[model samples]
Target: MFKFLGYLFLMGYILIPASMAQNHVFVEAESFDNKGGWVIDQQSFAVMQSSYLMAHGMGEPVSDASTTVQFPKAGTYQMWVRTKDWAPYPKGPGQFQMSIDGKPLPTVYGASGNDEWKWYKGERITVKQLQVKLAIQDLTGFNGRCDAILFTESTDFTPPNTLDELTAFRKKQLKLSDQPMEAGHFDLVVVGGGIAGTTAAISGSRLGLKVALIQNRPVLGGNNSSEVRVHLMGDIDKNHYPKLGRIVRELDNGDPGNGNPNAKEYGDARKIAIVKAEKNISLFLNTHVYRLEKQQDIITAVIGRDIATNQEIRFTGSFFSDCTGDGTLGYLAGADFRMGRESQAETGESLASTKADDFTLGTSNLWASTPRDSVSTFPRLPWALQFSDEYHIDEPQSDWQWETGFGNYNTITQAEQIRDHNLRAIYGNWSYLKNNKAEKYAKHKLAWVAYIGGKRESRRILGDHILNQMDVQEGKFYKDGTVTATWTIDLHFPDKKNSQYFEGQEFFAGTKHIRVAPYTIPYRCLYSRNIQNLFMAGRNISTTHVAFGSTRVMRTCGMMGEVVGMAAYVAKKHNTTPRGVYQDYLSDLLVLVKDEPTPQP
Candidate 1:
């Protein structure tokens, strides 16, 4: 029996022999030894069951990703590849090929006209050697993706197609234990590595709580990370609890400008350094928390799966924080939550919709282009979103405005589709500029494009008090008000001009700003109402859609995290719950919120 070696970071491999009892070999595309220019895409992992490798070279073919595979014996094998035609309307532009050793496969994958992911059969090949190299060669730089490859001597064996079956199959194949390995107990567990989650973990750690900070992505900051490139917004350190944003200030180097082409401006390393400096905090990167272990209504542990290896780890904690932006953790724990807009009558907020509908703020997949020394050429894609001179965006760079999914799509389940729609818009617009308006953009080339969608709104975990627009606009201060929100009620809508062309699937966005005086959000808005021990920060906080417009910004959300952390400290000290901190220990919490020592890096 040949045991699988743990993942090798330098080689990006988890070597295992194919001679095992299963007889079939499964290779995850994301586990390629040399990824070359391919990227790991985990955005649709929950829906798709696995993180795949994508070639996001912006219409240019990326370098091939290669790995070594060991076969049990030299024999003919049937191969199947899990993939899909991303744009299968006419023909997929994201076409790619596979190579065994050095010879390319006859079947061109990703253009099979299959919209849903399925196993596409490839030509059976004779394995001449026990060890051979496998490679993925991209033909189009558009977003060709591969989930996993299967090789089996039994021709009748087929991989599972359904989500539940596929998940179980993968677990069995990977030898993942049904019982997750322990990730240690913590006083507080903060899920998500965004600004709010980072601050929450740091604040809790500094306040004498052992903390675990879990982030799904490789880097922190979420939208502010180089991957999404959104600048920090909202004012900090000017609230009733002035010391609440101390950790935020220490982490905010400066604005990198939304969708900046230069990655250095985002300060990914700086954020990592700050989180690592906290001794009481344990940081888990590329770990996505999906399952919750609960007793009654309170979450006792969270199960996180490593995005790369599919290894599951259980984190037990006395207190839990839902900073996943999408309220993923809260949802798993059966926390009461809200989504989309609320009716004006429901919240008594003037900015809310007259009648409730699912018209929430859209998600953005920002892109940027830079001028090159030499002229650049782009292929006209018939399958991409068709854009005419009157319909296309003329800008060289996309900011927060290059958004989609305002009222049409579910921001969570349809996230992958939303991102693809944005990609089609971007590529189509760029194609028009390069082919039709050649003189203007002759030297311009696509520099950067975010594959990870910068989401605005999702499930808002219900809390003790749901803040509304009137609370901010009327400057009504509650006695329990803690985090101060200072940004305008900037609600985004589908741009009318773009909507006229694309109808229900608008790719551009516009916003109306309802200016408001700086207002403090009540402490009751920070913790789950039904799920007793649950706390929330970031865009998932309890608020009407109108109030969320002001509180969703990074700086404002970070302050909410700081407040949650302080409240957690008081709760831990007194052996009380999050609401208990507000009810019985409000004074103790306020002292910490108002005079907590500034975080040092």
Candidate 2:
């Protein structure tokens, strides 16, 4: 029977073929009917710009992932899979093979190739039946990955190697849309669903503006989400926007510690329900904004792709918010932004270096372990980086300070390298503790390890006024002061002990806490100087490296969101841009801010 299998299911952005060719098939690993023990990993999308299916066996071989495919023609076809050799060296730990109709392939892939993505070819075979089973069998289960598979009768055809070229190829082959589908028209569109973004959407919607909240992940709260598990820091309901932060308080996670074992502490379910209940707001999750459309200096629309469905949605809004911690939306819109540290000569920051440098705070893939009644055994890792006694993490639990990638790599561009480095550090440490000193870790088993690493700093989108360390130190109060940042100027650097052992490869970090009284951040630092209609909240807001230490906390970012939400309404009412909210309609916005709560219509 000729049937349209998973491949035929069309998303809004994916173009339906004019006609089906029975001999050629392209299967996305993530779209497999049955994933078995294989898990879908999208974290490296920042680096690889694509998602894949991985056999995360944790040092053990996992079950096979299988799918039923119905072939229209019983003819000879060549097979090829897009994957990476994680270990890259010969006879690496991670290895897997492809099976067709119960017959395993002769060659084992993903073990002895380079780290770069390439097509691993397989044998040409004649289909004996109209329907056959395709399976990916894991050999080692140590994180062998598969992005996609191609079965074609064309003997001379080869897939593109680079990301850009491959994207063009896929667009041509799949017949994808030249333009994205219209998602919706909104008074305000917030590009991130963190506390800052969630509150921004709620505030705007309650004030009678149609809002759209786009989140790349499945849940709200960004870094504070259960996946990352960082508790909300800094203060709310204090200073200028006393009444402004009621919304943030409504959705705050009450988790006392960073790596809470109780799943309920993350508040993922509660946030989804609350956002779903709001009538004026439209929330789109699992949608990543990768591109933007701008007319002159004003942002006209943003283009986002749904990771699961591969459907692209073009959101049109009068005003847009870049709350994505990476400042993704702003960067796409060509907003002026700064990455890395500025020199003391440039910003006159006391803590800054004599010269500018490309060093930013590191990222932490926080993890936790629980003590079980029975002793649990973890696999010994020979492929991981070795840690000396001085640098070894002796405990089973690792928190926020277990950070990496500061001077080692770029947190934004080289994200995969950073993630892999962090993973190696974690696995290497755990393996050493479990293997060498078994008795110490006998009762503890790994409970949770965040694959979605919690990032600290990336791009800081420059606004009309860039808040600096001097501003926080002197407590400079601007006439347009909106959000009160209360956290100390807490900066992080590589721990001296760890640095001594690992040198430039240190994974652990130590904080340099400089206490400061709460200070007001002006409205001028909330919107882009060049991008007229762009508004910003969260860690991406206009602040120098030193000043960001205080404003980067979740609560302060949430309050910034609250202010942006109020200002969005004023922008819509007065028919102006984000700058206009600070210039012409400051009084109207301040009225909304000072009041306890604006009555929801």
Candidate 3:
């Protein structure tokens, strides 16, 4: 028996390495020690000698570096890590990277562990050849190490033989599909069109790329477009949030990103100005990305379905980013995400419920009108789902009846139906004058149902950290934080009519005063927990629902877009990923935003 145990232990160290996709062993160094490559985090390093796993420290270096590894074979694989620190050193919980033969592995971070040398193992790593090099780094600047490894053989894993492989890997990891996208072989692909997408694509194109923007709408400005009909709302670079929404400034009438425009009836001339300014970025309007295509975890292409043409398209890129307000691209692509409110118990907000989930406040199709010559008698909405006599208004000038079909059907589809419904509702509501038989209801016709609808109240992409109301109320300042949200938790509850669509028993959305100053939005919220090379913007960033309600505002979302854009730029410059910016290259990101608040709008 003793001899058998010895043989097994020796086999653990000597058996030929399998070509599996797993991170059993990781590098403990930053740069490549040999072969111009480094291995980072796999799974857990089996704590053979202790009860706990190895750990790294913040601002502390683990210098016991080993790069050259005697591997038996090679293949595609992902590194899994069970790492932690003594109360995440204010800055973070870093990651362990794996680089083999000059190829780097996607380092997944945001794990919690303790002081013991716990056992961690890598997923099945796929190896193709023998004897490759590896290196690792403490991404959070924390002190830690990797131990055990699985090193199994994997089939789904695609080996990174070339840069095309890298791009393909990233695209697959980001959930970008096989469909062709407008941005082909571009240096950068800005995912969301709305204002951010447009600006980012233009900016990146200017910086040089076949910049392509994947906008889900026929036109741009997403919620502010003629499709949704919701008015443009938000203030630019004011005192509190401090007008940092540069995208708004450059567009939106060049108003410095702070003007509150009720309507851009001038055919979004300002928006058109910005769009026409860029000759580089090809706008893929009416395009929707369903999946990501890539090898390993790096993004390569965004698979999309064009609404107008109803054709599948693929947009490949050197670097891909998401600016979609709902973050649909990132979510379907295997990015880490979260939803709903963090109960008051979790986030310590007075309005938060006690439970947590992936729920969020929905969009609103707003209507704008001025007082007409006379009052139009409203029809008795007999077929109206929530219409009632008690709901009748006497001197109704501005009515918020958008609560009609909310939560009735799918939200993604709701935009299409409700947009038309709102118009019909307006005309039909006005038609009540002919039916009500009241003189007060004279010849007042419908004005407008807004050009866009307010979409996505609280969609949070689960990141390394969840920005909660407490973080805002407490004015939490984080060294690892990249952006900030300055709005209040403005949630809207379901009307008393239909309770089915309501996410929680308690609905929230009402904040008039800006009680809190600027709250730091963490860096972790920008990327995914599982897939690497993916970045997020808009309301889908990781945050409590209540916090999301506040940050989901247009101006704030735009800032998030700019931050992610700048971060991507930084990552590209550094030849790393989004997570890389938060770890070792944070200063580079902050330097971009360090300028004075310059909202040109």
lDDT of 2 by residue, 1-601 (tens): 0022122334321332111243467666766667788877776676566677888766677899887665667888898888877765344566889998888998787876588778878888788796778899999867788888778888988878788887766555455576876766899999999988998888888888889899988889888888788999988856766776788888986755787766679899998888878888888887888888889999989988766556567889999999998999889889999988899999989888688888899988887878899988877666666765555888878878888877578888877667666777787888788777777888887776676778999999999899999999889999889888789998899999888877898789999889888799998888999999999999998989999888999988888888888888899888988888888889988888788446477
Q: Write the per-residue lDDT of candidate 1 for residues 1-601, one digit (tens) a residue.
A: 0012122322223553122336777787887767889998888876986788999999889999888888778999889899999888767887899999989998999987777999988878899898989999999889999998888888898889999998887777667677986778999999999999999999998878889999999999998899898999999857877767888997786987899999999999999999889988888888888888999998899998777667677899999999999999989988899898899888888778999998878899998999999998999889888989777788899888999888799898888899999998999889998999888899999999999999999999999999987898998899899888899999998889988999997989999888888899999999999988999999999999999999999999988888888888889999999999988999998888878855433
Prediction 3 global C-alpha lDDT:
0.51
TM-score of model 3 relative to the true fold? 0.60
State each model's CA lDDT, in order.
0.87, 0.81, 0.51
Give lDDT: candidate 1, residue 510: 92
Cα lDDT tens digits, model 3, 396-505, are 23333353332443344334344333433333344454355355545543343442445664345666677777787888878866556666666665555324432332
At residue 454, give the lDDT of candidate 2.
Answer: 87
Q: What C-alpha lDDT, on a 0 to 100 scale, does residue 59 get in candidate 3?
A: 26
Question: How close to the true structure is residue 359 of candidate 1, measured as C-alpha lDDT?
Answer: 81
| Better candidate number, 1 or 3, judged by TM-score | 1
What CA root-mean-square deviation does each model show from the true structure?
A: 2.7, 3.6, 22.5
lDDT of 1: 0.87
Model 2, position 467, has a per-residue lDDT of: 97
| True lDDT of residue 528, candidate 3 | 67
Among residues 3 or more apart in sequence or in different chains, the pairs in candidate 2 whose N, CA or C atoms overlap within 3 Å are none
- Which scores greater on lDDT, model 2 or model 3? 2
